[model samples]
Structures are given as C-alpha cells and as structure tokens.
Target: MARLPRLSVTDLPHLVLWQGHNRHAVFADDDDRQAFLALLTDAAAREGVELHAYALLDVSLWLLVTPRRVGALPRLMQGVGRTYVRRFNQRHGRTGTLWEGRYRATVLAPQELLAALVFLDHQPVRAGLASAPEDWAWSSHRHYAGAASLRALHAPAAWWGLGDTPFAREAAYRQRVHDGLPPEHERRLHEAAVKGWPLGDAQFLAALEAQTGRRARPARPGRPRKGGSKSVPKLS
Candidate 1:
C-alpha cells in the first residue's frame, strides 16, 4: 500500500520517533551523541522548530517539537538527518543509511502536551537504560528537572504554566514525571505515533480535519448501511 503524507500542521506540538536501520545502534559513544545533539539544535533553529523535549536511546530517538510553519518540521528533520548521517559515517568508517525509514510522528492537542512530555522523559527508564529520568544524560529531562540548562530548548506554555518560577516549575515537572503515565496512556501514545494518527478528543480531531483537510483519526469500520443517516463518524 502507498504511504500517507505526514500529517503536519503548523503551531501544534508533535511527537516524533526515528529509529536506526535494523535496530542497530545509532550513537556509538558520548561524542557521537553530542554531535547529533549539536546538529539537531542547529537544524531546529534554522527551520524555526521549537524543541520542547527529547530522548536519545541507543537505537532510536524521540522528540517533542512544535513547528512555526507548515514545512518547518520536515525541513528540520531532513537537515539534521542528512548532516548527522554524513558525519557519523565519516567518524565511524562505515557507510549506508542510518535511519530505518521515514520518521513516525503524530500531532498532539493542547491537553496532551504534559502527558507527552512525561512520556518522552520516561523513555530511558522504560527501556532499562536508566534507573530514573534524571540519570539519562542525553535527554532534555535534566534540563526540565532543573539539574541542567540547555539554551536551545524552548519550554512550551503548558510547562511554563506549571508554576510562577523556574524552580517551582522544575519541581512540579519532576514530581509529575515521578507520578508517571498510566499504562493505557503510554500504550495509546505509542500506537498513535507508530500509526501516524493525531491524538486528541473528538472536538480536537474535528477541528484539525477542518483546518487541514485531512483525516486526523481512523475512519469508522464497515461500509455505510443502506438508508442510514449521512452523519460524520465519531473518533473511537
């Protein structure tokens, strides 16, 4: 079957995931990870994409970002991917594609932002790479948790609304992460990203479809029954 074009809308937060080819390691060492992050920071700035949260696992990376314009997200990803692949190949003395394929992404509603952030932060822990989110050195967790500051990261409104001061916000965010996502919430997030479907309630999905002229959620099962009311289907 033919693939659908990525459902990218301007001014919306998106959860993006890209994995290595054949599940191979993408970052061989600390230097490789640092280089990839530098490339990402530069590309995001040039493409006008706001980086809100990120996690770098050995075989895959997840990013939560908001693009300022229609094509900003793709441009940023392409720039970072191409440049990083070249540099990595040179440094490692290997050749061939690094990524598995096109990256997977799903647009998010305002209500889902904080949950997405927590999900991204907990990726390392879920993968058994860290005892806690704070132990992951390559992710934006440290920055959000008040242990470090990354100038390139832009905190979204949801994060800022956590508290009146930086310390307060950080503390609140840390506690939220500690609380963690429900198993069902985590499963839904993973399913949405992998399937490239927008994650939201019915109203949000309707608004998104009206604005973008594309389906934001799956269509209802089965063909329309004869003489049935011609109403739009609700998102399940």
Candidate 2:
C-alpha cells in the first residue's frame, strides 16, 4: 500500500509539526533546545525563509515558516536538517539519522491558529516535562509574548498576523495561550498535536483555503501494518 505523503507548505498554507525518528527525544535540555533553534536561524539565513513563530518540544519542534522563493524550500530544509543532525549526533555521542521522517504539516486558519500555537506551547505539559507550557522556557512563546527573540528563531510579528505594535500582539498571544484548550474537550486534547503533527478543524481549514489559496491533496494509501509488530504508539 502507498503511504500518505508528508504534508508540505508547497501544498498547503499550514502550521507544521514534526519530530525525530522513532519519537526519540532529541532535545534533551535547555541548551540542546536552544541549539536546535539556532540551527533554524542559520537555515533561515541560507534559505531566505521567514519563520514567524515556533515551539520546541522534547522530541520535536513546531514551526510557522514561509519561504520567500519558490524553489528554495528544499535546499533550505536540507541545509538545516543536515546541520542539526550532525550537531545532535556529536553532542549526544550517537551516530546515524536523528529524524524519523519528513515533517508533517497541516493547513490552518487564523481563528484556529491560536489553538495551534497553544498546542505547540503545551507540549511539555503533555509530555510530562513541566506543569505548564510557559514553565518550559524553551519555546518561542517568549518571542511571541514580546520578549526579545533569541536571534536564532527569527520570530517576527507578521507571522501571527500581529500588526505593527509588538506589545499588542504579545498581549494577544499570551491571552490565547493562557486560554488553554476550550472547556473540557479532552477527547480532542491530543489530537491537535500528536508527536509534532498538527491537525486542524474542518471549518477553520475551509477558511484557511481562502486565505492561503493552497489545497491539500488527498491522503495516500499507506503501507500495510505488520502482524504482531512490536512498534506501536500507546493512545492516551
């Protein structure tokens, strides 16, 4: 069977979430997380891309990026990915690929965007790293919340549709994240963000189509599951 192709910005205007191979925890500590973000900065310099805002999780990273040029996206990814993996291997004393597969992306609308950002920020809480998203300190939450960007992230206000005033956008961002997942929607709690994969709502997605003018292709048929395969993700 064929597999659903990994979502790409080329095909959709989205909020991207992706992670390392086998759900491995590549971002160990603060330094590690910051280091990875720095790679994103370098990638931006090389690729001519603008990364609006992003969040760093234990095993993955969520990014909001747009390429300025049409053909530069792949080269941009290759440059950053290769450099990041190289550093990750050296620091951890490990060898081999650090990523699981291509990053998974999903189209999202502005109204639902706040939710997506919150989902990314709250990863640590979900992953058992901290009690709340703000407590983690490694995410781009600060950048959005009006803190001076760490330079590597290249966080810009325009990314979030925040206009010229940085303070207003920051206040709005904080409020949105502080709001949490709507009242008692526990079933969909983890669905929005599953291991760096962000899924959006049908209504908002329709709006997103209008705003970005990008259409998502249908999901491809994936490979058959092996009988008694030991690898399985436990559904919480």
Candidate 3:
C-alpha cells in the first residue's frame, strides 16, 4: 500500500499534524522558530486560511487553521515549507525536504473547535517545552490576549462579542484558556486525544452527526496493534 497524494478537497477545515522529516528537529532552536514563523506569516497573507491558534515548540509545531478557499491548502503549505527549508538548509549546512511528507490532516467540525484551540495553544506544555502555555513566546496566545498585533493570523474580534470591545474579548478568551482548565474540560482533553472527534454540547454533536452521517459516540475501537487479539474480519 502506498500513501495517497493529498486529495484536493473543497473548502473544509482540517486539523493538521505535520512532523519534521525523519522525526528530525525542524525547529532546532529559537532562530529556527522565528524563521519558520516569518515564512508562515508571509505565506498566510497570500492564502485565505484563518490561522486561529498555534504553538511553536522546540522541535515541531501545531496549528489550528481553516482554509477559506478550496484547492489552495496544499499550495499555501508548500509555500511556507519551501521558504523555511531553504533558509534552514543554508543556515545549518543541510539540504532536501524538511518535512516528512504530505501532512496528516483530519477534517473537523466546529463542534471540536474549542478543543482544537486548547490543544494547539497547550502544545508547548504537552511537549515539555514550557511549564505553561503562555510562557512560550512563539505562539498566537499573546495575539488572542490582545497583547500583540496579529495581522496574518485572523482570529476575528466578533468571535468574542461579549467583551465591551474587541480587545476585551481577546483578553477574556485568553483568561479562559490560560486559567487551568476545569475538571470537565480537562477530561474533555483526554477524550479528544482518543476519540479524535468534537466533544461538546448536544447541538454540536447533532450537527457533526448530520455532516458525517454517524452518531458521535463516547469512544470507538482504536488502531490495532500486532501480537494482540485476533483481527476482526470485515463484514461484506
């Protein structure tokens, strides 16, 4: 079996997880992270995708992006990859593709939107780069908190309409994400990791079910490993 090329899909949001080639450290250090962001911001300006959340760790990074145009994701991703790799190779005396290959992406529903936001923001902590998410400098956390100006990463002000102003809304969102998550929300994190589906309100589940044509269950069978139970035969 061969890996299929990234099928060009219509305008759909995806949760992407792209690792460095050979599991090598793509962001070797601070300089590497800055270089990557610079390229990313530039490319993002040309694409319509909204980079809602992200975290720049020491090795790999995470992102929560929604493509605004169909068939443009690959080109936009390639643009950032090429720009960063070119600089990375010149600086480190290396060459070749920096990325592993076509990135892993899962089309998601808005129901899972908040979970994705928290995960992307907390990637640094989860990866052991920092004790807290806000400590990491190279991330959209500050942007969301209204501390920094983010022109490329488009997290609209209206999303948080409760605030007296757009800046206030950003601040509120930051506090919600930064303040240690509630127990139920913490549990939600565990569920998202295993289920890979949005866990939220009943209405959200209904919407997801409609789109996927499958009811959202608490948990499903996970990927199989060898030297375990007998393989379940497929029903034809």
TM-score of each: 0.94, 0.69, 0.71
- Between prediction 1 and prediction 2, which has the larger lDDT? 1
Cα-based lDDT at residue 155, candidate 2? 47
RMSD of candidate 3 to the truth, in angstroms, is 5.9
lDDT (Cα atoms) of all candidates against the true structure: 0.92, 0.62, 0.66
Which one wins on lDDT? 1
Tens digit of per-residue lDDT, candidate 3, span 84-164: 889999999997888877665555555556656666777777788778777888888777766787777766433455387
How many clashes show up per model?
A: 0, 6, 0
Tens digits of per-residue lDDT for model 2 on 1-236?
A: 45544434442335666677898986877888778777777777777776656777878777766566654456666777888788888888999988876765554434454555666677677778778766778766776676656565544333447655767777877877788776444234344333323346665445544554543323334543777555433222
Q: In model 3, where do residues sit more than 4 Å from their true spots?
A: 1-12, 156-158, 180-236
**Per-residue accuracy of model 1 over 76-119 as CA lDDT, tens digit each:** 99889999999999999999999998999999998899999999
Q: On a 0 to 100 scale, what is the lDDT of residue 52 in model 1?
A: 93
Deviation from native of the Cα of residue 124 in model 3, angstroms: 1.0
Ten residues in a row with the worst lDDT in model 3?
1-10
